[model samples]
Target chain A: MFNLIRRDFIIQKRQLVMYVLLILFFVLLGRQDPAFIFLLASIIIPVNTIAYDEKPETNILMNSLPYTRNEIIASRFLGTIVFIILATGVTSVLMYVFNRPFTTTDIAISSSLALFLLSLYLPMSYIIKPGYSAPTALISFLVLAGIVPPIVSYLGERLTSVTDFLLNLPVPIFYTSALLLGIVFYGTSWGVTTFIYRRKAF
Target chain B: MENVVEFNNVTKRFKDFSVKNIDLQIQRGFVHGFIGANGAGKSTTIKMMMNLLQPDAGEVKVFGMDYKTHEKAIKERIGFVYDANVFFENLNLKDIKRIVAPAYKHWDNTLFTQYVEQFELPLNKSIKNFSKGMQMKASLAIALSHHAELIIMDEPTAGLDPIFRRELLGVLQELMLDGNRTIFFSTHITTDLNRIADYIAFINRGQLVFNDSIHDITENYALVKGRTEFLDRDTEKAFVHINRLSTGFEALTENVSSVKRTFGDSVVVEHATLEDIMFHLKGGLQHV
Candidate 1:
């Protein structure tokens, strides 16, 4: 399973230099939040690797390996976590080097959001064509990010009863429940992707 | 002898095409050639064997274990080569070796190196830069080095020159010489199978036409050519596939004795090749 992860690195060797350059470029913009850089770096490699698998031949190559479809999906999920950790660690070191201000809260939020985003997108990528999935995910993420919060706040302003009920809840409970929901969603996405992949005809 | 692979009532359906009730058996220790035209169910069937595709009904078994239930175990012992390139094209041979070598428990680096040297494949050059033949040789090298008991190849020789195809077939024959390893090779090129395949399984329009020993198939089917006048209504019925030419009528038939009885000295009867058998099996719109 780690070999599957290693394969992604081998295939992405040429892109590693560009990724490093991006990290340096992001570092030069020292005022920019380190968490944002970490998030971007984490997603870039994995998303591109997934996009490269849009070719049916890559599916064939992966399926031809001795690993089960479940193992393959597990590797992808595990690889994402590893990438998130590495990206965060590297970015944290760079952030300290550049004297950029960031807290553990930023790391926690950025990493969790990356996982949540991946959980939402990776299954869609598996279900749909990679070429379509990557662009669709990006556009959808941008559109939702730009629109969802304002719409929610506007609805909250319009409906006091609904806003009051939500604002009354304890902060810790809300955070814990949201964390649990994210974990459940991520686990379910992994299961769904495995099921879809197992039945997929090469 | 134990059967290495078996498909019992396996069926796969697509929106427009389907392969149904495909029953096949491949015994151990022989070169089994799967012959079909393009778009036939040969690849589909092979995919099912590899568990790359799920069957709509029935089951596929490898090494007496269900393919789906024991996929890892089955795949570990089976080396597969696709008709098209399957490796990451941007990665070089060394990179591929690094990725693929660990997947198999019995992967032999010495054997892999020997094949790389034998095939004269450059280590550092990317697979995308290699020619089609070189790509196939690389695939074969990987497949062979794993010490896999069964080697499954789909159209592995489609792009190679005659010399390379022969050499590839020779390698397969050598693999089976020990009577412990087996090969399941799919191809549209029948002549390659004629030289090396012990058993021939022919599929057409998503159906198994015949699965028999090459010798038995050749013995059973014959090609007959005769003057047009000799192809009477009764004699025409005997031809499995018949073509009306300007000079004469040539037909293929399994009822060779009856055809001989009917035409006697008027027709020429000859043994059929795998290509001829496949041509005749299509039933119409194919000549020679």
Candidate 2:
């Protein structure tokens, strides 16, 4: 399974530079946005990586290998985790080198958000056909980004006191809750993707 | 006696066509030629035996183990090359060696390299840049280098030119020197099968017509061409398959010696080649 992941990684090694450049450009544009590079690494990279795989019909070749389907899926999931860890380390060094303003809280929040979002995205990408998946995922991201402002504005006035109470909670509780949510969502998505893989004919 | 590969009443359903209760067996040593028309479920059956596709109703066993439960065990001994190149198109032969070498415990990089040189495949060039024959040669090289006991190839002879085909057939003849090794394969070219295959498994319309030794299929069945009404009804029944034409009825029969005994010297009984036997068994054509 690790070998399979290594194969995917090596095949996509040429595209890694493009990803880094995209992140750097976005970071320059959205300097006000903390965790920009982490977002690019986690959410952007995993989905498009999967998209690249589907384009060449690599699944059939993967199927012909000795590995089982579940092993293949597990390898992808674990590979993403490995990539996230390595990318976060690299992005952290870059931010420090450039003297960018990013605290531990900001890193935790961004990484957790990317994890939650990408975890949900994976099962969708696997279950839906690739042609429809990319457009649909992009549209969903756009719609959510579009709606966030008004929802935050509306909730701010209506629940000012409640928001204050929740915001005043201990930092450890927040981190622990975020960690639990990431684990649960990722586990659920993994299960669903495994089901989809087993039922897939090709 | 354990066959290298066996499909015991396995059935699989596709969108448009279905394989119904396919029972196939290929023992060690001899090459088994799986012959069928296009979409006759030849590849489907092979895939089922390899456990690449699951059977809807029955079981498949490779090397005496249930394929699903012991797939790793089964795959360990079988080298498979499909009709298409199943490796990354942009990857080179060296990349393939790197990717696949770790999958098998007994992988021999030395032999693999030897094959690379022998087939004259460039080590560093992407497989996408290789010609069709070169790609097939690379596939064969990779399949053979693993020291597998059985090789299951689907249309391995399809796109090769006649000279290359003859070379491959000669290689297969040499591979059979290992008395314990076997090959079960499928191809549309009857001449290729005639050159090397010792056993023949014929399939038509998703049903297997018969499975037997090449000698048995050739010697037992005689192509009989004569007047339509000259033969009795039982003689017609004895034919494996017969098609009646405007001038006469064409037929193939298993009762060659018996028919000669019954008909005296008037009836014509001609020895059949593998092609003619397959043609008659599939459906004997009408005589002009």
The top-ranked prediction according to DockQ is 1
> What are the per-model DockQ values?
0.84, 0.50
Clashes of 2: 0
lDDT (Cα) of model 2: 0.78
**What is candidate 2's CAPRI-style docking category based on DockQ?**
medium
How close is every model to the real structure, measured as TM-score?
0.94, 0.92
Task: Please write out the lDDT profile of model 2 over residues B1-288, one tens digit for every residue.
Answer: 458877788788888999898888888888999998788889888877766678898888888888557766677787877778777787888887787777776678888888788888998899989988898899888888878899889999898899988888887888899998899899889888877888999888788877899888878888777777767877666677777778887677887887676665666678877777767766645421
| Model 2 residue B193 lDDT score | 83
The fraction of reference A/B contacts recovered in model 1 reads 0.89
Clashing pairs in 1: none
